[model samples]
Target chain A: MLGGGFAEAVTPLNLLLCLTGVILGTVVGVLPGLGTAMAIALLVPVTFQLDPTGAFIMFAGVYFGGQFGGATTAILLNTPGQSSSMATAFEGFLMAKNRRAPQALATAVLGSFLASIVAVTLVVFFSPLMVNLAVGFGPPEYFALTVLAFLATSAVVTGDMLRGLSSLGIGLAVAMVGIDEQSGAVRFTLGSTQLLDGISVVVVTVGLLAIGEVLHVASRSRRAPATETVASGRPWLSRRDLSRSWRPWLRGTALGIPFGVIPAGGAEIPTFLSYGTEKSLSRRRGGGDEFDRGAIEGVAGPEAANNATTATSLVPLLGLGLPTSATAAIMLGAFQQYGMRPGPLLFTQESDLVWALLASLFIGSAMLLVLNLPFAPIWAKLLRIPRNYLYAGIVVFATLGVYTTRSAVFDVLLLYVIGALGFLLRRYGFPIAPVLIGVILGPLAETSLRRAMAMSQGDVGVLVDSPFAVALYSVLVLAVVVSLVLRARNRRRAA
Target chain B: MSASVHRTTPAGESPALGDGARSFWTGRSELFVGVLVIALGGFLLIRSAMMDVPSSVSFLGPRFFPVVVGTLLAVLGVALSVRTLLPRSAATADEAGGGDGSAVSSAESDSAEAGARSDWKPLLLTGATLAAHLALLQTAGWVIAGALLFWGVSCALGSGHKLRDLGISFVVSAAVQLAFSAGLGLPLPSGVLVGVF
Candidate 1:
């Protein structure tokens, strides 16, 4: 099956699609205020005409390329393309500032490549087992899983728990719009015929990440400080840099793969975890480690972790029909558009498509490495473009992307409204990830809860009946408790 | 542009004055966010109540989840508001430090100062441009409306090169129009220049 999948993915047309997708993804990822989610959302309309396998192969390429490409901007410009790259920006940007732009870029690329390869390998091997486990999950278990997702994302993603919860609440409220699925009752449409189908996630994602980011940038009084671009030397790691990076790379991969398997939104948590781990390890080493000042381990570990988590996030999306991030949610929408459902049955029902997608992941990872490594310097030069024209181009693209989705002017209006909300969220320090997660998962959670309730005939005990539910609930409790404890400890230390 | 406006105030005088001003604003901002959340919750509750569900539906009707979510939101909003009103707690102080156990209040003050300095004109202009583009889309076509939007955003962002910006916007909009409509078959409105392209 693996061999056959590879053969399918390696076709001339499919390979061409993969290259186009990756190149597009790189361009978007390198630009500040544009992200993988926005890129994927924009690509969906274009991919509508393609076959499922070919389209998905391109998406995989885009996904890998976007994740890897973000590092270039983060390193050179001190501006992350997305929040997941925030950790990369922390140390990688410092490295570039210290005149090691080439080294930082190379470290990021190699780390991403290595972790992606490991993650894809894990997916190829462990997906069957995951599918079997997922097949056993009923409504109660699935509801438990979503609860876990909500708790994990809201609790872990943001620094302020209250703000995160508020963001989550706002997202759930947004999700509640349009007609109710069960009773055919129109909930929050406010007598608009166009909104009966609900606010499209494409519009929401593009609005928040793209349009909102542009607004936020525009509102800033001070432009970003001029970046010091040095002549990038040959992209290679020293013997010392290699030896130092390898362990962190492996550790980051280990830390990141599990996050992907679960619906933990994006790679934000794992990348942070990797960075924190590398920082502590370097600190303990205590001899010229330079952990605070552009440590290579700091860049390598988090970059690897981010790409690894991105690759593995597909496991849940593919095998369990759960979308952990905004991009995944959009991909899930794409799946539905084709009248194909993703889950345990997907493997059997659409075996060829699944294989081709899996095969494309490997090919895309390799393609990303080939494209990014040699061109890291050129990609960094994207920052030299005039800010006005760059941002103006983004606005035009964003408008076109949103308008093309449903050709409804109402969506364009909604886009600005959501963009305003996004700006406020950022200004007030509200984490945007939970909102996207909630919008994606809220309906599924409601459906699952209702199904569970109907099954038990309002007994309510059915929610905790299964062992899986019990285990999931226990984990949720543990996660909340641990986060609370950590918060208290940090507070005490601060005091 | 306005390089003279970038001159820094005397460091000591500004920090002391800024801190006094910032704390008050931060506290009020938190309260405002809380009130907004509570209001949204109330709206959701009212809207959910107005939802006409069929009597045939069982215990888990459409209103149950919305009501629950609204109630939770309202409660959380109150908590957030109360927390903001109370004297500064150590936990929140730590949170203001960026949660890394570093510089207690400086990080908070820096970001607050940055926020204070934000210029809203560009944001407003961008919003206006989007609105105008959407309004003109049907009457003016993709090329004209999109180019106008592009030019408007460029001007808003402080681009001085009008002719250059206009040329770029025209080329970009036309290129996108061609790619999406001609290449991909996505129907874009072709208003005034309907037959020309």
Candidate 2:
């Protein structure tokens, strides 16, 4: 069913590129304040200078490479290298503190790498089926889907649904800032020429996540000291760890792919849902005691789900121009940079690049596994870096990165402002993920909504007229009610 | 030896901030954030009203999207603020009690102090150096700013010594520059000295 030459096309050079990307990605991933976005931003300009295939190969490698690498910091250190790794931190850190760092790290890497490969394979083989599914989508359906996405936003992004939902609203408002496409009138731009094109998602992402993280670290510098050593545990998976992990790994993959396809706030939801599911299903490990205390399944399922969802997230991004997560949003930028438009057409138009990229996925996983699994102890050493200095460096890198993107002093200033805002949002319990989801998806959602409305002569009824749209709306309504009911029920039960 | 600040917290909860402070930090701040969001929404709504939003048939127009988003933001912001203000009863509290399952005894507190012995100078020093890097990169060039950034952050994050950290930062930045600017061909900003060899 597959071509031999294509499989073997992963030559030494391809391997070298994959290895280099994974290594660089891992280093960046292990570090705080930097993530796939920063990594991609720094690396994107370089993709232009190399062979398209080789460059794409490396980009694909680094893309997943960053995902795999982010988990290292999430588990070993409390800081997540990427936002997607946040759910991993919820349970992974507990395992680390319980002297089970080895198993936790192992399961995380293996789960991530394995799930990515599976998802990549699915993309390669079943992409056409996915496109067919996406083709059936209509404007009303999209609107309903977005509502469902919003419903899950609070649950996936933050501990409190209200905060997450509020954040989502703020995001939609930010998305509204540019021109009114249908009316051709300026809405929120207050007469700045730069506001004509709207704020670049690149600028917002780099500023909010990268710059925000830097400022956050700086605030803590005065109050906290930095440490140089992490948990000195054997990084290799023990047999007991292996025995506890395999089932959850499978369960995680199943949970991840469905949620990923549904467009409900990215992998975070699946990871959290997986965590909650595993926490419940877990047999009382210590004879009547709950598994929350150093429970291996806590680490295993969520980590697996995190990877699975991240991998499967590509389905929507490629099949439809929809991005459910921030990383996917950035990846959409990457596709645009290459002058490739995503949607149903991408599968046919960019078939070679798609396959080659898929090939690189398998290669990237192998490299990450080799790097992370065997050399996890070496990565653990990175936590030994002093926090103040680490954060201070983040400030420097974030500034330099923003400056390089546009070479404007204003951008640097923007970075600092964003950094401070990020610190405040984080210091409070406001989740930063929605802000990103907003910045990235906001424009598209608004444009689609307005476009759909205009087509129907401003009839709100048309949005629900389509059966597919009606079904989607029903799902959204169901999600909101179910989650609310579940929360109230949980509260009652606990009471 | 300087004490480490980040790792000293036994779990997500910071001992430095007590329960009242923690609740206020999380709760009151949510309310404040809600107000700020509502205000931003109002500003957007006002701006949309001023714009010449062209109308359509018997349904909504361009203003509809912004209006809907703003209204939702305002309503949700109010809900969030109100929720934060209300104190939860004992029953709901237990459900939210998921923290890292570490019992930090008084004896463990002493060990935590022992584990925290790392300096804060590197972090502060790096921040200042980075500020200098940004201020001077245009005049001094990429080599200086880039290297300073690398060296500064490494030092601030607590590398063992200046000599070793300086060497690593220099080599790393230089290699990055060569790969990015020379090999791949995306020209980095050289600041003030443009085209002057």
Candidate 3:
């Protein structure tokens, strides 16, 4: 299966798509406000023209390539393109300012490549096991997992759990539109033909991520001030830097893999943890505050953690059909767009597409190393593009992308309505991921719960009757408790 | 474009939410959220109640999940609303605690929690531009409408180069039309100048 996947992935068409995806992903990642998830969200509609296998391969490339691009900006400009690279900025910018930018860039690149290899290898070996386990799941188990995903995303993705839940509720309400499959009764369409099909995830995402972003930037006329960066320097690492970085790279990958599986919303947690671990280890080694003065371990460890979590996060998305991050959620939307329901069945049914995607991930990460290592400084120059043109171009793509989704003028109008909502949500501190999750998983969640209810003939106990479901519920409770405890701790520390 | 005026007056100031108002609304905006959610919940409950039931044998029906979700939202809305009355709801004090946001996107949450005000004029202009695009899509070809969208949005974003914006917008729109029609095989609307292409 692995060999077959490699053969399929190396085809010229797949290779070209992968290259395009990674390059596009890197460009967006380097641009402020266009994070990986939003990039994928906007791209989903454009890739509608491509075959399923090629689209998935490209999406995978974007996912991997985004990590390198984000890290480059963080090191050189002290601005993290995506939030996952914030920890990298903590130490990376210092190294760059201290005139060791070359060494910092090198460690980040090598660490990401090594971590991607380690994480992807583990995924290749372990994914089939996850699929096997998921294959045994019933409606109850599936319902329980979706509930876990919903609750975890709502509670863990935002600062305020209530706000997150509110966003989730709005998404659910939106999802409630269109025909009810079980009874063929339309719920929230309000008697419109277009409403019968329900709101397109593509429409909502483009409006929210792109149009909403344009509005947000428009509202904040004070553009993010550009900082200085070097023009022509290839990232290079000395023997000393390599010796210092290898162990941290391994440790960071170890730290990040578990986060990929849990519905923890993103990789920021593991990156911070990896950074802390490196700081302590440096202290333990009597390195005299290496963390303060741009240590190689500081850059290596968190970069590894960020990339590792990105790769491993796909496991749940592919094996279990649960998306833990916004990017993964949109990718799930892409899968559904092709009428391929993700989960255990997808592994067996769309095995060719899934395996080819995994194979391309390996190829893409290797390409990321080659493309980003020497071109780190050049990618940072993307920031120098006129903000007016950057935003203007995004607006053009936003309207075009949405219009082409169904070629309906009404959809473009709907895009603005959702765009306003997106702008409002961002303005008010509401977590956007839950809305996407609620939009994507809301239907499956409803269907599974009703199926479980129907099967048990109204006995609610059947919902929690299974040990696997009970285990998932327990994890949910544990997550809530952990969050509460952490909140209290942080409050006390702040006081 | 008036740098002096913008510099003297803060960036986010418009005829909308002020900095003082924003600070008050920042963390404490739970009241606003609570009220909006309660309204939504009420609407959902009413809709679920009015829907026709296809069967009585099944314990769960089409309305069942919506009713449950509605009730949950309503209860959450009430909780948030009531919590606002307490001393703890002072998001003013939330500065320290806000830093401890979720692992997923705490970095971004920090900015939103900062209660940064919006420049409503530009925001409104951007909205109007989209509305115009929608209105003009049928009458105006995509090239004209799409270019207008690009130019309008750039102007709203405070671009000073009007002629340049127009030129760039037209180039972008025509290029997109060509790509979509020939390459992607999805034809866009060629409204007024139908035979030009």
Highest-DockQ candidate: 3
Q: How many backbone clashes does candidate 2 have?
A: 17
lDDT of 3 by residue, A1-495 (tens): 878899999999999999999999999888766788877877888988889999999998888777788888888888788778888988898898888888899999999999999999888988898999999899999999999999998875466777778878888888888888887777866678998988999988888778877887887747557676563455777888889999999999999998888887788888889999999988988995778888889899999999999999889999999998887888898898899988899989989988898899899998898888888888898898888789888888877888887889989888899988887777656677888899999999999999999998889999999999999999899888998788778777766
Error of 3 at B129 (Å): 0.9
Which one is best on lDDT? 3
User: Which CAPRI level is candidate 1?
Assistant: acceptable
Give the TM-score between model 1's chain B and the true chain B.
0.72
Ranking of candidates on lDDT, top first = 3, 1, 2
lDDT of 1 at B52: 86
* Candidate 3 chain A, poorest ten consecutive residues by summed lDDT: A223-232
Alpha-carbon error at A363 in model 1, in Å?
A: 0.6
Evaluating just chain A, the predictions reach TM-scores of 0.93, 0.82, 0.98
Per-residue lDDT tens digits of candidate 2, residues A1-495? 225325633778877887888887777777654666567655654455556667667766776767766677777776666656766776777777777777788888888776777777776666667788767776666666556555555453344565566667766776676676556767788787666666655566666666555544543434443232255666667787788788888888888877666656556567777877777777544422446566777777877787777677777777777666656666776676566767777767776766676677777887788788868757756766665456545555556556665666656655555555554555444555566666656656666676677678777787788777777677767766776677678667866
Per-candidate Cα lDDT values, in order, are: 0.78, 0.63, 0.81
* lDDT by residue (tens digit), candidate 2, B1-197: 00121223323233458766764443233456668777877886786677775554224566777887788777877776665466544312531521111110000111222213223354346447656776867777776677787777666555567797777666665675666577646466665445542
Comparing 1 with 2 on TM-score, the higher-scoring candidate is: 1
DockQ of each: 0.32, 0.20, 0.39
